[model samples]
Target: MSTTTQEAFWSGEFGKAYSDRNNWTSAQYDDFYRHEWGITKTQMNEDCLRDLPKDAKILEVGCNIGLQLRCLQEMGFTNLYGIELQHYAVEKAKEIVKNVNIIQGSGFDIPFKDSYFDVVVTNGVLIHIAPDDLPRIMSEMVRCSKKYVWGFEYFASSLVNINYRGNEGFLWKADYSKIFQENFHQLQEIYRKMYPYVSASQQGNMDYMYLLEKQ
Candidate 1:
């Protein structure tokens, strides 16, 4: 399995399969949104929208099934946009959040203009991006956000190499503060313990949230 194979696997059949398994019903999403992220729809809305101005523009990367869109709307966020690569997930998101501006696109190349969004948020999306492509993806995220960018992801203490048959890949154990410091002047770091049920086998593993502001 080469880089091309990994990309093809994710963009082609794997996307459909994941979306089919995860996005087909509201209940499926409710469980995932709550337990996985440690937040209910109501809580997510409050956290994302807190201290922001009225009608703030928000862009969510990899907004699967629009769970965050619905949450934001419920909390009175009017200007909401999302970018997703999976077509099935995009369709499901559209169906779920009829009013949001959801576009089918890759995170590596966001279709939005620079400094267009007030707040950009991504949950559990960055880990899937290949390590070699991370710099471009991070640059794109920083380019689009005008005020703040927040991310929730799994990070390890050391680089992890994942090998599947002939395919070999690796993910850098992201130094949250270090990464943001390179690009943003003001940054805050928060660590959270992920629930065991989400990855029962990975017992001591944890997730982190990084909130960044462009200086």
Candidate 2:
């Protein structure tokens, strides 16, 4: 059983619905990334993960359907792993992404040893975590990573709560990279990119991607 409401919500039917909606193949996501960011998803991964060995062990938290892990696989990273809160998503991921291990798990308590992976990542996942719960999940990411922590999430200078699907307390935006650095003294921000919404009316809305190396 999930220990928190947020975890419960994500592990239940709602998360399955989200997984269904985002069931894009790696090639499909390549096109979507090009349309949304003017760069391929593989290019974005290469930008942040450059210089890492092809056999470097990588883990993605909340890897719904394993699309990002598939992207990493396409880039020649052989040792890959992912954890998803939803069991349905984990099953779906296994069906689509080969060789990578995708398991049903939670970020708050990742089922791995400390420094188990060379890089630990989350894509558009943290925004759903309540602010007070962020540290627990972030700590798990840090604990499991030997060298790097990567994240892509909605960005705002300060905490901004937004109603999601007519439900309150389900989503938020904040300076996640800044927060991570503030809490984890060992982390140093190595790279960051902000991609604003493509439409003019949503100009102010943007997503932030960041890489932090542990020293």
- The clash count of every prediction, one per candidate, is 2, 0
Taking all chains together, each candidate's TM-score versus the true structure is 0.78, 0.96
Model 2 per-residue lDDT tens digits across residues 92-173? 9999899998888888899999999999999988999999999999999999999999998999999999999988888999
C-alpha root-mean-square deviation, each candidate: 3.9, 1.3
- Return the top candidate by lDDT: 2
Clashing pairs in 2: none
Model 1, 1-215: lDDT tens digits are 12333345556766677667665344555566567555554554455446777598989987877876776776677899998877778888888887889998877788889999987888777666676676677888888988788776667665565453344552334544456556555544432333223445545666665567665
Please give the TM-score that candidate 2 achieves against the real structure: 0.96
